[model samples]
Target chain A: MATSVEQPQTLIYVLGVTVIFLASALIGIMYLAQIDISQEYTLYNIQYSSTVSRMVNSPTCFALEESFELPEGYGTETQVQAGIIDWWKFNSGITKVCSDGRIIYAYLSSLDGTLQKQLLTGRDPLTALSDSDLESIDNWNTKQEKYYVLVYKDSQLIPAILEVRIKG
Target chain B: MKKAGGAFLTELLLATVLVLIIAAGFFGIQHIPGFSLEPEAKALIQSVGDNEICNVNLLNLIRSPNEDGTLGDTLITSYLTKDYTVFNETTTNILNQVMLRRWVMNLSINNRVEATFGDPAGFVAVPCIAYVPLPQPFFSNCSFSEIQTGFDGYEINFTTPDGNVTMEIVNQFVTDSDKIGGFGVYPTSEWTTIPETAIIGEPTTINDTLNADLLILQIYVGDESEEVLIPYELTISEPSEDPDGLTEVHLTKKDLVQQCSIALNLFVELNNE
Candidate 1:
């Protein structure tokens, strides 16, 4: 009879311990999963910003070139201004003029959403990212939009933005 | 049965120990810092938050030509003239267009917030702040005077960037239970009453709205009164289109470039929703 009583007590103890252990394991797994997700998102943000900065500041990209009359009738001097997009240059595939090895897929649009032009740099992602792949929830990707000054034709400067989406 | 029970207890103990070891190892790995993003990655993230984007946006905006084919001098003109209409319109329109997230932009002159454009509410998370260095505005517009109301006490009057402010000593306590004497703030057009509580040695604060941005006076009515630092606001008003003779209404390029040195702060928050 004493043995039987001790067996139930030990069983209860073991049951309680198992419950607590399982609960802790579940919580730990959830917490670690959260940390992983956050870290990935942070990395994606860093990558997106890096790519956008490269495109915006690089003269070979969409940066607008300004012309000014030099002193003493030195004709005219033209130089690239960072963060200013030239519409003509963008249309002429300026990115293709010089390959930077890095992949970029973006769209430039007017602030009022009037005009939108697709920008692609590098390859593979074009073939890798299918319509179904984009819709998949598990697909890792980051998208960000940044503002820029769009120089239309050779005169008008309109406010514009670039939206970049990256998948890796 | 006794032997079986003992075996069960031993197995439970072993399981507990194994679980603890695994948990400890997992947690230990997390603290090692090897599983994080690289330093360059972190810096890039920080720049993305504020610096890189803000600098690019602000510079482009400043360089953009206005309606009259003049370089964007909105920030300078607004600070000098104190007419935020054009500045607000330009910044608001562009910011709304460019920003894909919620943000607040504050134009500060001498560390004083002159103009704020955004709803600074609800989103209380950490903001990515971008600070753009500005030329120091000439603080040539400050005046001060003291008027003796009675023998024991007097009133101090001063002008700041915001407006005029007047502070007077309170000779009598508001209530018998009041510990320390406070100031009666007559803020030019408004009357401000002081709090009736005090901590024996500390100076009493006189809160007024006249120059809320720049002036806050704390008067200690004790033996050998304490001298407080008086901060003056910038007052050299440049030219604008205002008909009021109080400010110079004509803004010149030279004045805008040389005189106006108002710093800009862009606080951006990614809209998680």
Candidate 2:
């Protein structure tokens, strides 16, 4: 009777050990899975950032006017031929080639706060953007992306911002 | 006691075997070819190609002659010999070429460096570099032929040391009903409102001795008075590789125009002189 009782106790102890081992293994696996997910996220973020950078720096942004022919007397005396921008064509070009699911805004402005020309897609044009809107756009929260680049407009390097909201 | 010990040992062995099998499978997934790194590699290659194009565009801008009558370091007014030297140095250094065996620039009155540069009708300027990697091949072997039909523009055929590489730069001019005449002095031809195609460069073929890695830049100065379209096509063949599967990179007329516009704008902005 004593041996039978001891056998039951030993079997129970073995079962308890196996349960503990399995639980630890599961926890270990979960930890590893979390690490892998984190790493993949980081890699994806890097790739996304690079793609956005390339888009911003693309030559299409600074495309010149179809023709640089000046009006008869415009630059005759100075002979200074400043490159002109075909704003409408450029806007369309960027829209067609830009990655989908992202809102893009391009603006040419003077050094002062005056807006010259603004191109917006995927959002309504606000006559004036409030500070809060700018904040939300810049912060990018979780699913959105924002990038700003400067292109030379004549002698001035004008700032152009591209904001994208990632899609599922 | 012996029976219990054997049972315990067997359980331990089975658990160990299971663990090993799982670990092996987990690590084995990474070794499969083209699984993890192909996307990254493709992205890198594309980035490199774009960078190369940008570099080449900048070099072209630097070599272009300034429009003003005053001659700074502009290549247009300089002696043809000096122009050749500058081209050689720039191409060799910027392109990282082993040697620029041959170089040529064909210019017309419309696209000449400046008004004073003179109208060189059918003039082909060849560089004076002495470095010839191979004996000059016969020009007939690499002459420009109308191999394919339906293309309204000019085509040039050349054989690189590696193999045959064909490059064609075409510009189609569409009449703008709103505007009369063409850009500058060249007006649209009266026949069918279709502007006559202007071929600026000479038909020079690359000597087969030249390096396989070649850089070709086709600048299409379109007629601004009307809508101008430029289409550029390049086909490259690796002699060592299968000729049947030729690699070609085509930039549609629209994209080519955009590239030219962007390049010109950037060139103007970056011009220090």
**Model 2, span B145-213: residue lDDT tens:** 222221324444433322343444343223223322222211111112212332123223322212232
lDDT of 1 by residue, B42-112 (tens): 44455454456666776676666676343345555666667888878877788777876666777775567
Docking class of 2: incorrect
lDDT of each: 0.52, 0.35
Model 2 per-residue lDDT tens digits across residues A57-115: 44344333233545543543322112223334344434545544455444444323343
In candidate 2, stretches whose alpha carbon ends up further than 4 angstroms from where it belongs are: A1-63, A68-103, A107-126, A139-168, B1-273
